[model samples]
Target chain A: MSAPTEIAIHHVDAGRMGFFTDTTVCIGCKACEVACKQWNDLPADGSQFTRGGSYDHTGELSAATWRHVRFVEIAENGGHLPQLPAGNEVDVDAAVAAMENWVFMSDVCKHCTNAGCLDACPTGALIRTEFDTVVLQPDVCNGCGYCVPACPFGVVDRDPRDGRAAKCTLCYDRLQDGLEPACAKACPTDSIQFGPYEELVRTAERRVSELRRRGIEGAYLYGAGDATGEQLAGGLGAFFLLTEPPERYGLPARAESPVQENVVPATAAAVAAGVLAAAGATAAFALARGRR
Target chain B: MSERDATPALGTRGEPASWARAGADVALQRTRWGDAAWSFLFGRDTGYAAAEAQPGEVAEANRRMRSGPLPDPVEGPFVKAPVWTWEVPLYFWFGGVAAGSSFVGLACDAAGDGRSAAVARKVALAAVLPCPPLLIVDLGRPARFLNMLRIFKPRSPMNTGAWALVAFSALGAGAVAADVAGRPRMARAAGAANAAIGGYLGSYTGILLAATAVPVWARSRLFLGPIFVSTATASGAAACRLALVAAGVPAGHPTRTALGNLETGAMLCELGLAQLNQRRLGRAARPLHEGRAGRLFRAAEWMVGAGLALRLVRRPLGPRVHHLASTLYLAGGLAFRYAWIEAGKASARDDEAVALMGRGAVTRGDALRRPGEARRLASAARRPRHNGRVGAAYAETVRRVSLVVERALRP
Candidate 1:
């Protein structure tokens, strides 16, 4: 792959851009999903059928389906749903009016600060755009598919037909023209809001505080890491504010970076291998003396 | 996007009906997400729910991990179905043998055993010279293989490995050439460099597997590297000793005895570390105990045990016994490498293991259930499988301790 800086030499800096996803207000209208397909010119990924139980069933993020909306409906004892809104009080009657009482969050590529797919792509086909979000240079990808499993979030995949890797670009083409991502643009409630990265984080934090202040206990902003700790992919460029645990929204409870997970074990294994080889060499003398 | 491509019309990725076919994926398109509303009242993976959540009916559990119906409809996430196939593992075995033989050559040189050193060097060259070609074959084409050298990203091990292979091969060629040209000093220096690289060459393949997110490989990270090196050196010892015996090295030669002892020690470490890794991994180790992988693992264990027994009487053992043990040791080494790979595929195929890499104790029943059984009977061990996995672990520890005692007090 060509050098990122040299590749972007003609294009001036656009500053950092990202998505501020508030899953709280999402209506799951799927307008963003449809719009992304149309803009990207991607084919439908076989999700038009009734998938038994869930509404908004595009399944998951794949090579084709860049933006996915996940629906989770939790009900306790009776038929009453867990629509315990900001007040923390569950009412059977109010939940009935809440679109079958399912929490809807539109999911997309996290575009992590430390993107594993980018790091793992041997061909350098995955590179950081001027806006700092990761994009796939499909023409340069050699179809190695290393980025597929390398993704901690499993957002990338090899297109079976072309034998090349594909994923969301955060609409890199749109960003060049000072336009927002298609999913964000088509979002009816502005749940998938796109803006400057820093501004989005600040506003997302304030939104979290607002939601929590209103009595939503689980209202936390995911992928907005500061100096304190690193969260999903060391804080995603595309992050979210959710009213439930990450797992409840089809996210990892602890979305660890592949680097952290790999380094510790790799070091230990390397050390052990080196030590065992040395020990075996020394033990040979002792064992031979006994044999004689 | 080519108009001719027309979306590729890829089918759902499911297990193929013809099990013998390799890498052919069929479409059973499924969405992994579903509402956890009234479905909570029913058991999971049992049946599909026709009804949606009742009006306002709050559900208890709605974890997206639990959203998919059980007995997974799609093939579990294998990512790339292990990019390095038969050629890679075979290359690993050959490269390891070369590395191990280099150590033998070094040892024989130090001990002033020129005949043994000569054979070892020849063996090392013979084994290693084929690696790059095997690796290229695995990569599908020489051009694609060259693509690996397109970058020097140490952050990516694949990048480092490509560069390392080039260096290792060049150094190995230089050593063999010097050895043949009767330039002992140049051969010595080249051999030393080759040996140093061999340390990495012999074991980096295992590290490559461990560095991946695959649960079985990831969990065995601490042991895989060591295990690879052990097998490499042990089998190298066997191959070198057999070559010397064929070259008419005297029956009572100290070099032969020492090599035999070295082989036993390495194999013992391999046996102990292998079981320890598998047991520590618990549910993740399931792949090592079932199917073709399991058979291969068992064969490797048996061969190691036989080789160890042969080592006990190696000083008095006839040339025929030495040859038999040598064959077994080499076979065992190959078995271990191949089995480790097959186990990786098995580990990836299991949906439950893929999903549940626990931070702590999960369920005991997950560990206890044998392969392909849907009915999970949760006993005292539960899903996290504390005691069941430990059953194999205890036996291994006992066998290892006895072998250590027997070898240590042999004189």
Candidate 2:
């Protein structure tokens, strides 16, 4: 007996996992934020609250905070806001009047196909899950921090407290339990959706087309069809459907794999270092013999 | 339970109250996350029942913390993996062994001491032994060791290295085998083979580094080759004396001093080469003098200096001092390898090294242009159209070289 090329659609494991984020529908309620924290049992972003920034403060994605809701207050009248302006040093009323759009996005680890952190990790602490998602094993991490700088998107981070690596698991536990991620479940406006990977892709595609029809031409899916594109076929496991170019959300336009450029120079340097050391020792011995 | 289910959850069952308190405290810490509904629902202790768990919970936590996360995350972009870190160290090991063995061989040959020759052979074999381990360590998948032989690309220094290493190993083994065989003719042939192979291997390691994208290694290729060659010569001498000692050869031998002088000369050259290379490269040399690499480099320099001092007082120290000197030289050589690895990595990591090397390269190119301009001016009288023209006109005249040459010769 051979495996069936065409199986009944119902019999297939078509429950591909994915994520749906509706930035427009998001009210910055942060209910998903609290749910993620409670479920994951993560620590606070920091000891102090950052006041200078706009509505949402958690700053950036780090070991502590997995989900970050960025609050960008769009002003009109070609003016700036009193505290958080869309532009720097402009009139508030004018900016508010001139404001064409107000935007908010919740950022998370992309689970990139070509994860730099995974590639740079010396201890094999980083790996890919069956779901094709990037996952980290903290226990094996040597805290070398090579993965920290290797990341193109700056997603993975080291916890200063434990000196071990930490990041979102895409709720691996919840995922294993046959439930949606806590954040997605807790989202009030269905802003976060989790399901089969394929379904999510189709849904995202349809959503983009619908948005474009509605004159939201800026709507775009980041890391959806591959953010770095075919240049790096290493597709992202945790991709995003964005309403703007990825750069606006701090995503790299073109991230090159470091492994491609590093092998040669690194090998050569190692050889030189080794040879010089041997020669130095040999020379020292010769000097000693000369005295005798 | 299946083997997977038999394994407990990553977070071990602990004192529920403490766990709950820990969660509660965390909640109190964050105002936005810790509202009344969350506080009411989870409570101060939540449902954590840590007290029921066994003492093994601690160990379990440690284990889970280590292995549970399985794979780490990809955070940023544009950072290359640390292939260099492992690669540089292996290079150090190979180069060190090669140079050390060669030094012993050179000294033994110069002394014409049979015991010294035997010692040199042993040292060479010993030096080569660490190479496989170093190479394996640098590879991500050590099990696929045979892949190193999959290609014979000339552009790849590593490919060339495999061959160099093979020749060196064979020659070294032959030399040692002949010495052990106690045959005069065989010993002489082995000695010659060792000398020729050792010289090529010693210098080629430097060229290997220089041929890469590594700015520091590439810029100092010429000097690096010579330095390693000379260092090998000194190490070979040291190994020769050490061998004689092991064989209990008589002390106060004149040949010992000659080997010592040879070593001293090599040390002086190494020191001069290091200084010159650094001066020429400037900021690119920072790695050689800083951090772990810097410490190792300084230690090597100190060892070489002290070894030189020992040479000056060998008469006072007597024959026993040769052993100590050989040991120092050996230690210093390893230190240099470690330092060089660390320094090269640093040079590659830091922007300054690349900038300095690039500037040096550009300057060298600029310098070459001046000589060409001067030559053009000297030959201007023969080509009137090209006379005094430097950039475009000089090129055009060169392009019409046959006509100009014929016109000048016709007169």
Candidate 3:
């Protein structure tokens, strides 16, 4: 897909830039998360060790926690992963054998082509940056919170301290300075790559084919092509290379902007119904008066 | 019979005294903040430290807290819950009332009933008075509420709705002023203008809710607007009727009778549309039928039903029955608004419903596709199926209902 027209209108000769997160290479070390938090100066949410003995304690992405590492443990038997034994004596080999795969995905905002949050914002708080990335202007936001539910990925949220919506800007400031995002810079495995949109898509396509040739049949590009049901409104600025279903990574298989479908029909129906009902009421009143 | 002897002497200093002393000791221990603070600071083995001292027990509790079935990542609450509180729905109800009353006032003027028209105009103005403050108070930054008018973005229903409300309020006030000044022609023109704006004011709140990622609201997009407008009409007519009664209008006044008929028709339409929308939503409508929202919806339905019944019997009971029916309609209209907003909140939290909607499973026929786009995508075998079984079933039901209604209307 071509870069959105808003990009050309807003910035002269600026190309669209985005992230390509290859989950297949993710190490789950969470360096990206730490770097994101550090660079953004986000407040710590305190330590929370998840119940399943999984190392992913920082839960889903929120206002403060932009980049999140999700841990999915799949079982070889197509059932739940066996819980760790309560006794001190544990069979490590058997437990390991029972697991089919343990996948880690670093999740962030999609910066959709047809962004729901941007369309839903009443105040001009959310804007498309020169690099075609969606950015929220915190100062202009009246904190109406329409953008919260408008997000299809459940990414943007209201900061409790201030009540203004917050999400990843895809590092707009860093992009302007010719520097990579902190998450991409800190990723040790090169899992999170940042560059021009076209180049990244080509690289992702080659990697997917290479992975398939290497017998990893599940390797595919999400949010880049129409093949995956996960194609969002047009496509995502930030997309992923995955080895499992999109849902396994807490992503929708398909998404649409409510604005395109719902607004016009609803408004038309309302106006039509209102006019018809008013006419009927007026007729009833007029007839009753005439009969008087 | 021997209670006095069997109860023993009151306050006798024996085993009872020892028990009382033990109780007092325990209460003193509980109330001693200084001792608790000292134990907390120094890690002393006071009785207060017992719970923290047992690491094994604490660990077990933590384990239990975390231990449960693993969450299904696919069944996601895909969007954040709406931040709107009570004020938003209250504003919607008041706005509807104002909008509906303005229309009724215009209708009364068209019918040449100037007395009732003047009263309706005043009622519309009063109803609109609370709307702005209610909307502003619900904003996260109340001080910057005027920022809503900063840009006129037609793409956003909220921005347009805000502008409509401002215009409606101004016209309503002007119409009321003209009525007081005995300028009937000017009042009629102003009231007509207000009613024109009211058409949007009464129903745009529904569009506002529908134009969101919330599953239930978006799925019912076709019907929410009509439902809300019908409720607004019912409540507005009811309010005008009550105002006329209070103004010492005769029970047999043609205007009063006409309003009763209008209110009844609107209430019936509101009830029918709500049911049809719920049926179409299927599993996604769970929020509307199950919880605090469900109870409110049930209450609203019953209130409307009772009002309809009262309307049917009002001929025998005289105009006093009109008062009760009108009150019921007003209350039901308010409750309907609250229930709908509450249901939208709950639907946003339903991960499975949201995910299914995203997958084009629940909201099947409501695909956001251009003409023949679905066919083209289907030919390529890339598009998600948008005509699923549930959608077909809902379509069949709608078809059947329309047929029945058509046959009933035919001579």
Error of 2 at A238 (Å): 23
Per-residue lDDT of model 2, residues A1-292, tens digit only: 1121111112234233556565655666777777877777666654222423233456666766677665544222232222655433446676456345455676677665445565455444565554545667543443444455455555666655444556777776555544567787687665565655655555555555555555765555554543122222144445555554333344443333232223344345435544554444445445555655
For model 1 the local lDDT of residue A240 reads 80
RMSD (Cα, Å) of candidate 3?
A: 19.8
Candidate 1 chain A lDDT trough over 10 residues, lowest sum: A1-10
Scored against the true structure, residue A50 in model 1 reaches a CA lDDT of 31
Please report the candidate that would top lDDT against the real structure: 3
State which candidate, 1 or 2, has the greater TM-score. 1
Query: Which residue pairs in model 3 clash with each other?
Result: B76-B351
List where candidate 3 sits over 4 angstroms from the true fold. Answer: A1-3, A7-9, A49-55, A74-100, A227-230, B1-75, B363-411
TM-scores, in order shown?
0.71, 0.45, 0.80
CAPRI class assigned to model 2: incorrect
Please provide, for model 3 over A164-273, each residue's C-alpha lDDT reduced to its tens digit, 9 standing for 90 to 100.
67789887765655567889878877788777787766666666655655676666666774433334666788988777666656676666566655787888888898
Q: Which regions of candidate 1 deviate over 4 angstroms?
A: A1-12, A27-59, A71-101, A143-145, A213-215, A225-227, A268-272, A275-279, A282-292, B1-84, B137-142, B242-252, B290-296, B310-318, B345-411
Q: Ranking by lDDT, best first?
A: 3, 1, 2
**RMSD in Å for candidate 1, one decimal?**
16.5
Writing each residue's lDDT as its tens digit, candidate 1 over B108-175 gives 76666666777777788878888878876554222334455555555565566667677877877787
Pick out the ten consecutive residues of candidate 3 chain B with the lowest summed lDDT.
B13-22
lDDT tens readout by residue for model 1, A4-55? 2312213465666788787877777888889998877777766442322334
